[model samples]
Target: MSAPEDRPLLRVVKGAPDDYQLAALTAVIAGLASVSPAEDKAARRSEWANPARRVRRPLQHGPGAWRASGFPG
Candidate 1:
């Protein structure tokens, strides 16, 4: 008997899928498997909730300090 690691990644139990259909299914599964949990969480994270936003920018101490403060870094 073949080991689990040597088994096929997918099996078509019901219908016979065409080459294109099988390729699409394989691509989708491979794409999903490539993304790590950390990357998935980062992708779902909101820009507003970013930790970088919490960190203050360096204070510009020049003539345009006040004006610069009004604009983002």
Candidate 2:
């Protein structure tokens, strides 16, 4: 079997690329390799869909009860 170092990093199947073109291609490939992948962020849960929201708040008695009911706990 051929050694790892013996294998070419890239190969030209058809068209012949100049030194500058090959250099640009190599730089692009190297840049892509160096970039870190974006983090897998956890999706935010909507407040409206929360289980706590589904549960009813305790009933308040007396003055301003109507106004309080309009507002969130």
Q: Top model by lDDT, which number?
A: 2
Residue 24 in candidate 2 has what lDDT? Answer: 99
Candidate 1 lDDT tens digits, 1-73: 9999999989999999999999999999999999877643445778898998889988899898999998987
| Residue 53, candidate 1: C-alpha displacement in angstroms | 18
Q: Cα RMSDs of all predictions?
A: 9.3, 4.0
List per-prediction Cα lDDT, in the order shown.
0.90, 0.93
Candidate 2, poorest ten consecutive residues by summed lDDT:
52-61
Cα error, candidate 2, residue 64 (Å): 5.9
- Runs of candidate 2 with Cα error greater than 4 angstroms are 48-73
Per-model TM-score, in order, reads 0.46, 0.60
- Model 2 clashing-pair count: 0
- lDDT of model number 1: 0.90
Estimate candidate 2's alpha-carbon lDDT, on a 0 to 1 scale. Answer: 0.93
Worst 10 contiguous positions by lDDT, candidate 1: 36-45
